[model samples]
Target chain A: MAIEVNGKMIEIDEEGFLVDREDWSEDVSEAIAGRDGIELKDEHIGLIDYFRDYYEEHQVHPTMRVLVLRLGGKIGKKFHDHKEYEKFLYMLFPSDPISELCKLAGLPKPLPSEHDG
Target chain B: MAKKNDEKGTTNPELNIPLLNELEEGQWPSFVSDLKQWSKTKPQVAQLLNQLEESYENRWNYWTGTVLNVSGYGGGVIARLSEKADKYPDLAEFHTIRVIPPPGFVYSTERLRNLADICEKHGAGILQLHGLTGDALALGFDNEGTFAAAEELMANGWDLGGSGPALRSLQCCVGQARCEMACFDTMKTTRFLTNHYISFLHRPELMYKFKIKVSGCANDCANAMIGSDMPIIGTWRGPMQIDQEKVAEYIEEKGVEHVIDNVITRCPTNCLSLKGKQMVVDNENCVRCMHCINVMHKALKPGKDRGVTICLGAKRTLKIGDTMSSVIVPFMKLETEEDFQNLTDLIDRMWEFWNDNGMDHERIGEFIARVGLATFLEGCGIDPDPRMVQSTRTSPYIKFEELAPGLFEGEQTQQPKVWNREPDTREPSD
Candidate 1:
């Protein structure tokens, strides 16, 4: 399957992940998030960027706990505690922050075992 | 979708189940006899027996598939399908619904009857009073039948137990309800924790299965120490209560030789001794192993100040091997709501650390093994306690520089040298 971004057709997998990582761009992310009825905000994009960076460095997606911990060191001075930061992340992507961020970031879907309840 | 079995018929009398007949010949009560008795009224049982016989003959289990979950849930229903369904069509889709029983497993006759009726109507007429994990097993159902039975069970105040990666049903001993040695109310604590984490029980999203078992005292009737991820065991601080009169009476009845052989010698801490006719306990040295109290319940009792000891990271053999739980919190007063909330917060912290660091299919215990226990404790922000360690380090290679920085500085003008040298920074050789 495929989705159209900026009038150019881009291939995607059945779960809507990008068929090619190189095909991913800002416009493609917006198109993917738009399909899920989520308007891409700056915070969402920030997490998406972190997800891409972490994956590039570690060859794995950052778990919710790792994301919260690393993000706290990076841009979480506003939040008093890690729990509050986690709550903020959840508020940004309520269903599953890690998987949702990965999708918008154009990364492969995480293992089902890593998904939270 | 499969059709329901014809409930009007009985077992075929001409059918020869030679393998199953052998099971009924034993002196001990046999499950074969029970199944045969139920087969008289429920044809599903007879078909299941036939399937079992076929499995025994072929040296292979016919059961497979796990797509028997109820709506909006991913667990609690285990599929038991027969691969030989073409031959035993009636036994094609056998399943078991795991219903979470109440804390303490107290049940009224009416509730039991209702459960039996539901099983008979929507499932095969068989009820395993309790499964290994303490959930009531309602056996033998198809896909649609499972939904029907689950809906009726929920409406009648019964909920399904957990399976897969979810938090399993909380198992608690009948504490304070019937047991005299109980240090706290096991039922209340179990019920509260269960209700609080009901979502975790119903959902299947964790890395692997987690279990919590509560025991009322150090006797650990619930097998909390080795069988669960989180073990809440009742414990006491300070001296245990000892009635001298009752002690004398016990000595009179059981004899001094019996007391010396059974209670005194068996004390793990070697704190118990006899002073004339009265028994003496070295309270300061007592580890509260519950051996003396169990043997002489009439004379000895738990201390007045009682609470629970919470431990973490226990599981059966899997990755690293069987590991017993380690004490995290030596004592926690589980009386007030705030206390329970604090316990919940601790669990949340531990779970967060585990979920982030744990690999797929890795239990919390294995996670601790991968990352050192000190790292796990520090990551969860748990205060390091002396009781958490089984014993002080026996090796002389202690990190004294990190532990005690300036112990010998002022006293001897000699500094403690750090034993661990810096890593070799030289380039690799060809």
Candidate 2:
């Protein structure tokens, strides 16, 4: 999938997941981070590697609950705070223009489709 | 996924709806409004919404009628009807339709046609094929042919209803019957349970919504506990195979490395123990989660004494409060249908108590939890089992002999920043 983010078209990698940093335009990173349900921080840039490692091993993104559990276990911290997690995830993928960001990152198409109708 | 956005512009008379925010969710879900928004960006989704909305359309009569309870799945249809209003004059006002489908079976296409034909002529063609599920829906059907459609479906060996409070078709995710994880034959037990309880299903006395989910070796793909009022979980009761025995060699063949570290260790019980080229499960510590078995499928096998744990006092949802689902039948061998029938008899007694004094449509969990557990047992003339009762829930925590600092030094992490502000208050302890 390709999208014109910030006036430049970037192609999503073959993994059906975007990997290139240059491709991660401000909006794209925000959206991916949002989809991952993580807060975007400079520290989170390395998150791509972590996600890659997780995907390499599991062959899939950790679903929201699984991600939280892994995070809690890895860091020995409780992910009991729901509001912070939700906000952090959104902070990475601000929904101001969700569609544009989702497209640039090559996320799966939204649930309902033309075929469904 | 629940969020519906606006479509860009192609406004059609049918799908044009008002825009609704999260605030209006409790007030009214204006699906039409949200679809209007989605159509602006994703026109196709709006089209699908229209397709689904048509179920509410065209020449319907509303008859407020109730009938004797036939099956527990019957209540879902009632709940569905309770959701609708008299506003949709285009749809037939079918107050009720008897839910009779094969117990623990799904309907095929041809049978669907016959049921549709029958319901179309006699009752309303609105066949809501709502079997037993947590999120069962009320789908629109043609009233004219629904009865024939139901019949047609039955003729082709399709089931419409079976799983409810009455008896459910024991379900598993292609367990040992096929999957590498199952310790024994799950399909055998499933068929046995269904074969034994043909009469209990239609009986009204034991009619309570219940579901029994069995995920052969844990990896709870079926989510048995969350979805069912009475959850029957599979477990083994012997030594775990941790040595490089016949199955341990297949651990790598089955790709059991990465999952072992994550899934096995996550077992709330410390039942999973690992050795060189071997993975073992602790019979006494195991809580039927099957995580260890799932993670190390090749190295692990359930013991010969394989059975199910029947947890009672449970419900599908706890949106209101902490509903009690207790371990009633702690263990039962699946060798015969008699075990399944014993479970059914217990369920019938539970239903009789709830229906007799439940006051208002109080669910089984609510009714049992409202009155003391003792009262429920006394009413049903069931002998109390101290081992399986509610008070025995205890965590198996192993405390290592080490300094707490050594154990906890790497535990510190940045705390989450909370945004919801609150008025200042001080605690006496603080």
Query: For each model in turn, which proportion of the native inter-chain contacts is also found?
Result: 0.02, 0.00
Which docking class does model 1 fall in? Answer: incorrect
List DockQ for all candidates: 0.08, 0.01
Candidate 1 lDDT by residue in tens digits, A1-117: 899888899998866788899898999999988887789888888878888888899899887546656665455332124545555665676545666788888888775542121
lDDT of each: 0.78, 0.46
Q: Model 1 over residues B1-430: C-alpha lDDT tens digits?
A: 2233552233343445899999889589998888888887777678788878888999998877634446556568877777876666666788888888889889999999999899899988789876657788888887678889999999998998587677888899999999999999999999998888776676454568888999999899988888899999999999999999999999999899999999999987788899999988899888888999999999999999999999888987778888888888989999999989888888878877787778878999899878876678778987555467533233221344443555556553343332233334456635
TM-score of each: 0.75, 0.49
Please state the error at residue B112 of candidate 2 in Å: 7.6
Query: Which residue runs does candidate 1 get wrong by more than 4 Å?
Result: A1-117, B1-15, B390-430
Q: What digit string (tens of lDDT, one per residue) describes model 2 on residues B9-112?
A: 23333553223233246766664565456455443344334434443343342323322122222222221221132233222223333344432234466766
Q: Give candidate 1's error at residue B411 in angstroms.
A: 18
What RMSD, rounded to one decimal, does every model reach?
A: 7.7, 25.7
Among these predictions, the greatest lDDT belongs to: 1
Residue B50 deviation, candidate 2, in Å?
5.4
Model 1 CA lDDT for position A13: 82
